[model samples]
Target: MAEWLNILLRSIGLFILVLLFARLMGKRQTSRMTFFDLITVIVIGVLTAAISLNLVNVLANGLIALAVWVFAPIGMYYLSIKSKMIRDIVQGRETVLVNHGKVLEDKLMEVRYTPEDLLSQLRKKNVFNFADVEFAIMEPSGEVSVLLKKDKQPITAKTLGVSVGHESVPQTVILDGVMMDEPLTAMGLNRQWLHTELEKIGVAPENVFIAQVDSAGQLYVDLFNDAIITPKPKTKDLLYVTLKKCQADCELYALGTKKKNAKKIYQESALELTEILDELEPLLKK
Candidate 1:
């Protein structure tokens, strides 16, 4: 009976220790879990359980040890934020993987990553060919950040040599089954205007999945019922056209690997964007 009781008490102590320690560590540390963090957690749990069955001051000692470990990271994080030196020590700086279509082998070695590993990360981003990548970065948190070759980049206003300011996201004036009064008022639209728009779209307020008005005064209406919604344009034709455009443009602007030029890959994307806009424009106008 005494042995059983001791086991029970130890189990309870282990559970409590893990709960408290886990809570102290932020969600990110646990969620994006690393090998070192997992091992540290296992060790703490085992140590707390072992001590729980021993001397009278076992609980107090365990708590104190847990507290020290818990706050130590917080203190380090605090110093890291305040001092550049400390920050470097805690979290290493970002490492560049590629520059100007050239692979930086030395940087890869510094990060202890092999060619296969780097390629694997790139493939995850849908970039299978190395020559297509102008820049790739492996952040300190083990996440990869990539910048495609200039020619592979989107034809944004700046890229097309056109000057344009920032574009704001559309405001949701109606959500679920209710109207957003604040957004309605801010956009110079009211309940009457919303009703008129819904009527034009052949959908009632109760039948809408979502409805919004953008800064350009374009109204986007999506209906909850498929029966009420207009039939969508054929995606197969649009997809083929878009893909061809992307491939062609990608080849023409081909900056990366010689195997697949920028013009050859993104040609289809151009056609698809144009087709999609044509279909959506009429719907919004209504």
Candidate 2:
């Protein structure tokens, strides 16, 4: 009975100590384990087990072993932040495996990485074709970072020479059929405005599962019942299209009209409309 009681007491005490040690180690160890981290984890596990099972005759010795494994890595990690040379020696340098869609066979062989292993890592990153890869490098954590060729990359506003507006993260104003006033207040909205929006869409506040208000003053609502469809907003995109068409119509009128008064009126309208569109372009297009 005394032997069983001792074992139980030891297990509880060691379990608590392990939790405290893990907290002190920080989250980097689990996020991306380096070569040294693996060794430290293994040694700590053995020491924890020895302490719990009373396999180590001296309790102090087992604890000392645990302390070294936990704290040494922390100290090295802090030193690594201050010194780049120390970091390179500890974590090793990243190796470039591919340059301009061509695999560097020498680098692969130096790292003992087979072609099959490279392909496996590339596939994990969703890069099926080697020809599409412009650059592929192996990180110290063994994770592969891939970059596609310039032509293979997705189109963006910068490539097309267009300016875009920046939108803030949408705030959840309604959740679980309850109106959250704090988010609505933060977004410069009120319950009356929300009620009006819900009424326009023919939806009740009770039916909503989640509702968010974006920077463009657009309300997005997800209801509990998926079968019912809600009407889409025709504010930004539709308004911009309509204004463009009106401007084009004015330009055509100015060209076709025989009367000088009508021609001047149409031309003036087109110029004024163009100025207005230029001001609103960033907000609508983005």
Candidate 3:
């Protein structure tokens, strides 16, 4: 084979081989890679380059070395999974940077991270003041996990003792002016309902840039024309409110009516409507 053709063939074969080996090695994002992982990746790249450029005289020798590098970590990963001791040794234990609003100077030194480094990482996590941090630990991946003081933490529904409806993943029912039938059907909706929603909003499907239906059954739309502000549909909320009003009106009529039969009918109607509202509340509010 020609020199250039030989190099090209070698590169192509190695690329596919490495890709297969990489998948077998398992998936780990570059950002989340440990120091050990980074070194392994560098060595693999160097070996691949050497083999591709004919720096290694024996292709078989290069392949063996590549195999060792690729499989070693995979074995370690499995071992690590089965044993906590192996995992701690391989990945290294996370160092505590802060405990109960106090920065550990000794732990910082052990991790070879300065106070500024901790502050920088904390800032990235939206935590500016170290005093507010309840605990901060640097993981083996070098990412800092932060916990704020109880009082410093943001108030959630649970914290406030508020009863909130569950929210599922929002479905993208429309993308780039095209209706996505799968997502609509997944949400127990149809194209007819989508069309009706579009009509109610006074915007054509073609004009919509993107549309998503949240768990609350609210259709959120972004129009292609930014100049036009499309109003969000609150059909579920309106229906809920309308039902509540009707129930209230029925109760009022029951109290006001002089005839016993009319009063009994009104009371029964109100009670039935209240039951319906109770049943539908979960679906309406998310």
lDDT of 2 by residue, 192-237 (tens): 9999999989999999999989888788899999999887765688
**Candidate 2 or 1, higher lDDT:** 2
Best by TM-score: 3
Q: Answer with 1 or 3, whichever has the higher lDDT.
A: 3
- Candidate order by TM-score, highest to lowest? 3, 2, 1
TM-score of each: 0.61, 0.79, 0.90
Output the better candidate (2/3) by TM-score.
3
Task: Quantify how close model 3 is to the true structure by its C-alpha RMSD in Å.
Answer: 2.4
Please give the CA lDDT of all the candidate structures: 0.70, 0.90, 0.90
The residue pairs in collision within model 3 are none
User: What number of clashing residue pairs does each candidate have, in the order they appear?
Assistant: 31, 0, 0
Worst 10 residues of 1 by lDDT: 231-240
By lDDT, the candidates rank as 3, 2, 1
Tens-digit per-residue lDDT, 139-211, candidate 1: 7677789899888876875566544433467889878867889998888889998887666656678766777
| Superposed model 3: Cα runs more than 4 Å off | 29-31, 268-286
lDDT of 3 at 258: 100
